[model samples]
Every structure is written in structure tokens, then in C-alpha cells.
Target: MSERQQAEAGRVRLASALSASGALTSEWVEAYQAVPRDWFVPDLIWPGRADGVRQEESAHRLADPARWWEAVYSDIPLTTQWDDGEHTGNGRGTTPTSSNSMPTMVFSMLAALNPQDGHRVLEIGTGTGWNAALLSHQVGDGNVVTVEVDQESAAAAKYRLAQAKCAPRIVVGDGAKGCPDGAPFDRVIATCSVRRVPYEWVAQARPGAVIVVPWAPEYGGEAVVRLTVGEDGTASGRFVGSSAFMRLRRQRAERPNSLAYLSGPWPADGVRSTTTLSPEDVGGWLAMFAVGARVPDAFPLVERYADGSYTLWLHDTAVTSWSTVDWEPGRTSYEVVQSGPRSLWDEVAAAHYWWRDQGHPGFERFGLTVTPEGETVWLDSPAT
Candidate 1:
């Protein structure tokens, strides 16, 4: 089939899938159809999954138009830039810095924004300009302010927007700071995930404005949080659904090498222990989120071996403590080593226990309350 015909067919399939899944609502249907994802996607891209974490190798349209076209319309994300556009060659980069997000996530977030015909929207991370184009179509170009930190990406998106004849105000600046010139915005949405909901965003938005963003804890689980700003300068809301997007550039975590934790040879200054809770028990995304919420300030890294065994390293952000759990396939108990004042493994286990006892609440049960003091997460209600 021709590229145009393929794109049209893909759109139909995508729209059907999204509609059946309830992500592509009637309110945003016109905008979704109007903004063809192909118009905003670049030729060279890395096709990734819906989770937004892993990517297959590069797929270039010029070299293989069929593969590139297939990737663009599929339900998965398309990584457009890597390592802030610093990496070389056609292969994958060390990190996925920017992307044309998955179609489902894009429309889901737009639906969460609950856009009105004339509502002024402040959008963070204008990676592909497709989202901005959709917003421009929904609420008028003048009412959409899209911010991107990377100059080259912002420029490219601007060119694409120009080609599409949907020119939203694209600002090349820190998205966390938001576009204050477009103050009192009716809605705020972020394409990138954030560890902390930036207070500056709250300050700029009008009361009762909805801010939809992908929020994650330091330990590594993410979800889309819908917060409604209050008159008292507080924004609180429940996590609408699970989501995974690249971290907001400035909010990205500082993950040091595992060697940094070890001062000397193997198990140096470490206390050895064993646990009935297997490493396999605490590996999935939900388990990570549950444990991360209780045990903040630490992150996990895994090192795999050829023998199907792996070591899960737990490190504190302070660089003061570290622990390791060795998991072999079918092992009932795992070998653990700890060093420093805080027993990272014990803390994790306790957090896991706490979560399990709480009935393993899903993302929706978790709510965030962001006030002048700080952010606090609660189960069901803030009082809890």
C-alpha cells in the first residue's frame, strides 16, 4: 500500500482500538483524527512499547518506509531523540530523552485534561508537536502554550506545527518552571514524568484548574495524577491510572554506578543475611510502586548473570547505604548483603509487607496532597 493509504488504515485501526479501550473519547475524537501522528513523527525513530521504557532498534523511513510507517501508527511509543540528541549513529542511545508518546497515553492524558473549547492550556514537554497540534485544534492555537527545554527539538516541533498550520506558542525553556507569561491557564499537562509536582505550576494556574501529570516515586513506579488546584494554594487528587514517561529532564534521578557503593572487594564491610521473600517477589511494576511509596529515598538496580541469576542492588540517594539481593531461578530464599547504618534490604522487605497487608492497593487508591509544606501520599483519603 502507499504511505498515505497505510497511514489512513493505521489511523482507523488505532482509533478503533483506542475507542474500544475507552481512551479515545468522543470529546477528543475530532482532534485525534485531525492531527495525524505521521505529520509530527520524524523519519529516523526508535520503536518502543506502551510502557515507554524499552525500545527495539532504529527504524528509518527512507531505508525502510514500511517498518517506519508501521511503528508510527501502532499503539506503542516512538522514540524520536536519544540522550538529549547527543548520541551518534542509527542504533539505540543510552537513554530515551524524547518521544512521540503512545497514542493511547496521548489521548488518555488529553481526556484527563478535560479540555474545553476555549480553555487556556499549559503543556510541558512539546516533544513531537503532535500533542500541541491536537490541543491547538481543540482549544484554538492562541490558547495553547507548549514548553520544551531542548532547543533543537523545540525548533523541529515548531517547523512541524507550521507545516500543519497549527502554531501553538512553543517556548524553549524549563517545563518545570512552566510558561508564566501564559498564566492563569485553565489546564496544565505534562508529557514527561515528575518526581515532585512543581509548585510553580500551581502558582501559575488559576484556582480549580486541573493539572494532569505522570508522577513517580524515586524508587521507580509511575502513574498519571490528576490534581485540582485549590483556593488555599494546594493541589490534591487521586492517581487516575498507571503511566510511564521519560522523566522531566531537570527532575531526572542521579543514578550512580554500583561500584560506588562498594568500597573494596566483594561484600566489604557488609553484613550477610537471608530472607524467605525471594527477589522475584518484588520485581514487577506494582510491587515497585507499593514498596517505593513506603521506602522513599532509595532506588533499585539489577545486574544479570549468564547462569540466569541476578543481583538486585538497592542504593540510598544519600550515598550512605547500599544492599544487594541475589536471586537465582526457583530459589525459595535469597542471599542478601547490607552495609551502613540503614539496612536497605530490611527496609524494602518491611515496605513490601506493609503494602501486602494493605491489600496491595492499586494506583487508583493512592492519592497525593501537595501543599506549601510538602507532598504527602495517602491511601483512600488524605486523612489516612
Candidate 2:
């Protein structure tokens, strides 16, 4: 089939799938049809999996139009820029800095935002301008302001938006600062994920305005949160659904490698022990969320060996402590080693047990409340 034929067919198939899955709702169908994903996607792209973690081989529109079209229309993210545009060529870069987000995530966030016909919307991380275009379609172009931290990405997104007849005010600056000139917006949304919801977003929004964003803790696991700006200068809400997106440039954390935390050679001055709790138990996305919520300033990394066995390394952001858990197949217990000031594994295990005791509550059951002081993740209600 021709490229045009493939594009149309793929679009139909994807729309059907998204609609059936309830990600693409009726309200956004017209906007989705109007602004095709291909218009924002570049010629060379790396398609991410449905889980939003892994990326497949590069698909070029010229060399392999079929694969490119398939990737464009599929309900998956397309990595457009890598390493803040320093890495070049088709090969994957050290990090995927920007992407046209997964269609399901895009629509789901839009549904959560629930913008009105003329509502003013502020978008952070205008990766490929696809989201900005979609928002411009839902609420008029003049009412939308999008901020992108990367100047190159902002320029490219501006060009695509113009081609698609979308002219939302594009600002190139720190997205965490938000667009101050466009203050007191009725609604705010961020395509990129943030470790902490910048208080600037809350301050820039009018009282009662809704702010939808992908919020992730330092450790792992992420979800989209729908927060309503309160009259008391606070924002709080629940996790609408699970999400995995690139971190906002300003909020990106500097994670030191495992070697940096060690004082001497392997297990030097370290305490060793064994535990019945499998290392695998605390590695799930939701499990990580629970542990990350309770165990602050800690993150996990995996080191795999030539054999199937691997070690999970937990490090504190403060660079003060580290722990290691060895995982092997069919093991009733696992070996753990700890060093420094904190008992990382013990804290993780305790957090995991707490989550299990609560019946493994899903993302919806957890909520976040951001105040001038800081943000708090609560269960069922903020008071708890």
C-alpha cells in the first residue's frame, strides 16, 4: 500500500484501539483527527514500547515509510531528540530528552485537564508541538502558552505548529519557571514529568484552576496527577493514572553512580545479612512507588552479570549510604549488604510491607498535596 494509504489505515486502527481503551474520548476525537501525529514527528524516530520504558530500532520515513507510519499511528511515544540534541544520527543516545508522548497518555492527560472552549492553558515541555497543537485545537490558539527549555526543540516545535496552523505562544526558557507573562491561566498541563510540582505553576494559576502533570518521585514509578489550585495558595489531587515521561529539564536530578558511594573495595566496612523478602518483590512499578513515597532520597539501580543473577543497588540521593541485594532464580532468601548511615534495604522492605498491608492500593488511591513548604503524598485523604 502507498504511504498515504498506510497513514490513513493506521490512524483509523489506532483511533479504534484508543477509543475502545477509553484513552481517546469523544471530546478530543475531532482534534485528534485534525492534527495528525506525523505532522509533528520527524523523519528519523525511535519508537518506544507500550510500557513506556524500552525503545525499538530507528524507523525512517524515507527508508522505511511503513515502519515509520506504523510507529507514528501506534499508541506509543516517539523519541525525537536525544541528550538535549547533542547526540546525532540514527543510533539511540545516552538519554531520550524529548519525545512525542504516547497517544494514550496524551489523550488521557487531556481528558484530565478537561479544558473548556476558551480556557487559557499553559503547557510545559513542548517536545514536538503535537500536544500544544492538540490543546490549541481544543481551546483556541491565542489562549494557549507553551514553554520549552530547549531552544532547538522550541524552534522545531514552532515550525511544526505553524505548518499545522497552530500558533500558541511559544516561549523558550526554564519550563519550571513557567510563563509568567501568561499568568493566572485557567488551566495548566505539562507533557514532561517533574519530581516536584514547581510552586511557580501554582502561583501562576488562578484560584480554582486545574493543573495536570506527570509527577514521579526520586526512586521510580510515575503517574499523572490532577491538582486543583486552592484559594489558599495550594494544589492537591489524586493520581489519575500511571505514566512514564521524560523528566522536565529543570527538575532533573544528578544521580551519582554506585562507585561514588563506596569507601573502599567490594563490601568494605559493610554489614551483610539475609532476608526472606525477595529483591523482586520491591521492583514492580507500583511497588517502587510505594517504597519511593515512604523511603525518601533513595533510588535503585540494577547491575546484571553474564549469568542470570543480578544485583539491585539502592543509593541515597545525599550520597551518604548504599545497599545491595543479590537476586537469583528460585531463591527463598536473598543476600544483602549495607554501608553508610542509612539502612536502605530495611526501609524499602518496611515500605513494601506497609503497601501490602494496605491491600496493594493502586495509583488512584494515592494523592499529593503541594504547599509552600513542600509536597506530601498521602493515601485516600491528605489528612492521613
Candidate 3:
């Protein structure tokens, strides 16, 4: 088929799928149809797997038009920039820095934002400007402002937005600080994820304004939170759904390697034990979120062996504690070794059990309340 024919066919198929999935709601359907994702996507791209954790080989529009169009029209995200635009060549970089987010995530977050006509909206990440374009279409160009940390990305997005005739104010700066000049916004949305919702965003928004952001704890797992700014200058709301966006640049965690926490070789001054709880139990996304919410300031890393067994290493941000749990096939219990002040495994197990006792609630059951003092993740209600 011709390129135009391919584009139309793919667009129709994707729109149908998204509509069936209930992500592409009627309100945003016009914007979705008008703002083609290809206009913002670059020539060379790395398509992410449907699982959202891995990337496939690069697809270039010039070299492989069919694959490029397929990826653009697919629901999955496409990684456009890697390692803050430092890494070169066709191979994947150490990290995916910028991406055209998956269509489901984009539209779902937009639906959660639910901006009205003429409502001033502030967008945190302008990865490829597709989201900014869509927002512009929904709520006029003059009322939208998008902040991007990467200058190169900001320039590219600006060009794309201009070409699409959707001109939202694009600010090249720290997205965490937000655009204070455009303060008193009616709505705020962040394409990037944050460990803490920057108070600047809350401060800039008017009372009763809504802030939709992908929030993740230090340990792992993440979800998009739909918070309403209260008269008291706080934002509180439940997690709308699961999400896996890139961390906001400024809020990205400084995770030390396991070697940094070791005082000696091998076990490294560790005490060993065993637990009835399997390592696999605490490794799922939701499980990690539950554990991370209660545990605080700790993260996990996995070291897999050729035999398919793996060691789950837990480390605190302070580097004062470390723990390891071994998992192999058909193991009822796992070996555990912990060192330093905090008993990491015990904390994780306790948190996991607490979640289980609470009926293993999904993201919707959990809520976050961000106050001037701090943020709290609560189950069922904030009082808890």
C-alpha cells in the first residue's frame, strides 16, 4: 500500500482499538483524529514492547516505512531519545529519556485531566509535543503551556507544534518548578512521573484545580494520580490507574549500586536467614508499590543466573542497609541475607502481608494526599 494509504489504514485500526478499549473517549476523539502521532515522532525510533519494559530494534521511516508506520499507529510507546540525547547509533541507550507515550496512557491521563474549553492547562513534559498538541486542540492554544527540561527536545517539539498549527507556550526549563509566569492555572498535567509532586505545581494552580500526574515511590511501581487542589493548598486523590512513565528529570532517584552498600566481599558482613514468603511474591509491580509505600527510601535490583535463579537485592538510599533474597524454581521458601541497621526483608514481608490482609488492593484503592508538610499514601481513605 502507499504511505498515505498505510497511514489512514493504521490510524483507523488504532482508533477502533482505542475506542473499543474505552481509552479514546468521545470528548477527545476529534483531537486524537486530528493530531497524527507521526507528525511529532522522529524519523528514527525505538518501539517499546507491549509489556512496556523493553524496547525492540530501531525502526527508521526512510529505511523501513512499513515498520515505522506500524509502530506509530500501535498502542505502545516509542522511545525517541535515549540517555538525555547523549547516546548515539541505532542500538538502544542506557536509558530511554524521551518517548511518545502509549496512546492508552496519553488519552487516559487526558480523560482524567478533563480540561474544559478555555481552561488554562500546564503540561510538565513535552516529549514530542503530541500531548501538547492534543491539549491545545481540546482547550485552545493560548491557554496551554508545556514545560520540557531538555532543550533539544523542546526545540523539536516546538517545531512539530508549529508545523501542526498548535502553538502552546513551550518553556525549556525544569518541569518540576513549572511555569510560574503562567500561574493560577485551572489544570495541571505531567507526562513524566515523580516521586514527589512538586509543590510548585500545586502552588501555581488555583484552588479546586485538578492535577493529574504519574506518581511512583522510590522502590518501584507507579500510577497516575488524579488530585484536586484543596482550599488548604494541598492535593489529595486516588490513583486512577497503573502507569510506567519516565521519571521527572529533577525527581529521579539517586540509586546506589549494591556494591556501594557492601562492607566486605560476598555476603558482606551479612546475617543469613530464610522466609516462608517467596521473593517472587514481592517482585510484581503492585507488590513493589505496596512495599515501597510503607518501607520508604529503599529500592530493589535483581541479579539473574544462567540457571534461571535470581537474587533480589534490596538497598536503602542512605547506603546503610542491604538485603538479598534468593529465588529458584520450586522453592517454597527463600534464603535471605541482610546487613546494616534496617532489616529490609522483614520490612518488605510485613508490608506485603499488610497489603494481603487488606485484600491486595489495586491502584484505585490506594490514594495519595500531598500536604505542605509531606505526602502520604493511604489505603481506603486518608485517615488511615
Candidate 4:
């Protein structure tokens, strides 16, 4: 078989494995079968995981179909950009702007979306047109409108989509505004993660339409949220799974924090769970909330590293206040009491307690409601 054909066979096998394991849905298999990922990916693009510790690596896309398909199907994230927009190639570190999300994650997202044939869809973040191509395959290509902010990226994606013969209307512009011309989409799916659900998405989607996107709290942890737009224009749904996606184009911002505030010790007695809980869960999200709310719009979750070190770095946004506790095996506990006007941990404790009393579950049941300017959450049982 030709190298490209050989790679397709391998990818198909991998997809089959993922499906047999139930990591992917059957429709997802059909989509994968219909769309060849290599078709949209540029012959040469940046690779995931830079070569060295310098935080930067050169773009490397080779001619070997086996290698190319392997890279495409790998579960690890590929870095699309770096240095926060200043650098694209080797030399120094840069932040990732886009990527071909892992196949399993993509399948999970599509499964969550479950867009029916002929359903109108608006996809935000047309990275390489790979995803938009798949969506177009399901819904008529004419029924899809995808928006990307990077002009060069947008142009490249359009050509790739055309080459793939998927003629989704690709727009080069800020996606936050939503495509007004394609208003009332049956499904609105954002490939990127966002700090808040945009009001425009809900407004542009037909009432009761599904909106699927990555929803994270003030902290960096992300949950794939699926909400049904309400007749009042609000949307609500809870997180279904975990995923890491590039941040939305317009949502990029830098907040600073004092590094001194970060180091701490995890509580010894363990967390008080009003709900069934894990130690890391308490330490991770609740701790982040405690720190940020006290620091208010200041301490944002920046870089989280292994070695038991997490950075809640922010600017004089006063987010410089960092609080980090050591990870204790089988023991994740925190006192989280603050001396300032705001008790960050106290609030987290309250949330945990509230959740605990309500049977200490449903972190998954957290639903989303969207308005034009703002978004809110509601508990499924009204208990937590």
C-alpha cells in the first residue's frame, strides 16, 4: 500500500480499537472513516512536545505517512504555537494556539454534541479545518460556518477544507461575536476552551439547541459542558468529561501574582466532604477558587506542573498571591483559612460542605445557562 494508504489503515485500526473499547461511538467511527485527517493537515506543521527544555521547538512535518498519521492520532496534545504569539518555530518557548485534538477527545465531544444530519451547526475555532471537515461530513457542508481569528490560519484552513472537498463556510474573524449571518444554529460547538460561555452563542442558537464547549471555573481545570439553550435564551448543562483544548483567541490574557504566596502544606486531617470526594479534588478546584476569589479576578490558574508544584500566577491584578500545598499521598487536606477580608478557603469549604450535604455528588450535574452578556449555573437537584 502507498504510505498514505498504509497510514490510513493504521489509523482505521486505531479507531477500531478505540471503538471496541467504547472510547468512541459508532457514529464517530463513521466520521473517522469518511474524513482523512492527513488530508487537512499541512504536509509540515509544528510537532507536539518540543525537543528540549528551552520551551521552544521548530515545526517538523515529514513526508512519511506512517509517522504523520501516528502524530495525528496520538493522544498527547500537539503544540500549535508558542511564546504567546511571538514565536512559531524553534528558539524560545511559546503558548499553543491550536491543535488537532486527540481522537478520543474529539469523539467524546462529537458524541456529546450528537448533531443530527441536516442540523445547522456553527463551529468556533477552525484550527486546520480537520474538525470542521468532520462536522461538515455529518451535516451538509453548506450548513456549517466556522470562525477562526488568525487570518493566516484561517486561509490555510480554508484551502485544506477545499482540498478535502468539505466546503464549510470558513470565516476569518473573532469567533466570540458568533456569526450573525448563521444565526439560530441547531448546534454550536467550540473547539477551544473559554472562561465563560458567550452570550452570543446562546443568542445565535435556536432555542433548545445544544451548545457544547469546554467550561472551566476561575481555575484551570476544564469540564466539557453541554447545555440546551432555553427559550429565554439561557443555556444549561453539566460537564460530561475532561479535556484540554487551546484557549479561545479572544480569551487570552495575562494575570500576574506574587510567587511567595504559592507554597503551603496540605491539611493533615483530610478534607471535609459534604459530598463523596477525592483529596485532590478538594485541593485542586476548591483551593483555586479560594485563592482567586480572595484575590478576585486576580489569581488565575496559570501553569500547573508535576513535582507537586502548581503556579497560580497573576499580575498586580493582585493575583500574585499564590498558595500551594504539598500533595500528600492518600491524604489531601487543607485548612484554607485566610486573615484578609476574604477567606478563600472558607468559601471553598462552604461549597464542599454544601455539596456534601446534598449527597456530595453531581459535580457532573452542574448545568449551564447562557444569556447574551453573562452565564450562570444551576444544580440539577436544587440541593447543591
Span of 10 residues, lowest total lDDT, candidate 3: 48-57
Ranked by lDDT, top first:
3, 2, 1, 4
Candidate 1: which pairs clash? Answer: none
Model 1 residue 195 distance off true place after TM-score fit, in angstroms: 0.8
Between prediction 1 and prediction 3, the one with superior TM-score is 3
Scored against the true structure, residue 109 in model 2 reaches a CA lDDT of: 96
Residues 1-384 of candidate 2: C-alpha lDDT, one tens digit per residue = 987888889889999999999999999999999998889999989998898765747889999988889899998888998899999888888999989999999999999999998799999999999999999999999999999999999999999999999999999999999999898899999999999999999999999999999999888999899999999999999999998889988778888889999899999777999999998899998889888999998999999998899999999999899999999998998999999899999999999999999999999999999988999999999997
Q: How far is candidate 2 from the true structure (C-alpha RMSD, Å)?
A: 1.0
Model 2 has an lDDT value of 0.93
Model 4 per-residue lDDT tens digits across residues 201-222? 8889998799899866654456
CA lDDT scores, all candidates in order: 0.91, 0.93, 0.93, 0.65
Number of backbone collisions per candidate: 0, 0, 0, 30
lDDT of 3 by residue, 1-384 (tens): 999999899889999999999999999989988898889999999998767965659999999999999999999999999999998789898989999999999999999999998899999999999999999999999999999999999999999999999999999999989999998899999999999999899999999999999999998999999999999999999999999999999987767788999898888799999998998899899988988899998889999999999999999998899999999999998899999999999899999999999999999999999888889999989999
Model 4 Cα shift for residue 247 (angstroms): 1.3
Clashing pairs in 2: none
**What residue runs in model 4 are displaced by over 4 Å at the alpha carbon?**
44-59, 63-66, 83-85, 90-92, 259-339, 349-363, 382-384
RMSD of 4: 6.0
Whichever of 3 and 4 has more TM-score, that candidate is 3
TM-score of 4: 0.78
Superposed by TM-score, candidate 4 places the C-alpha of residue 72 at a distance from the truth, in angstroms, of 1.8
Candidate 3: deviation at residue 13, Å? 0.9
lDDT of 4 at 323: 31
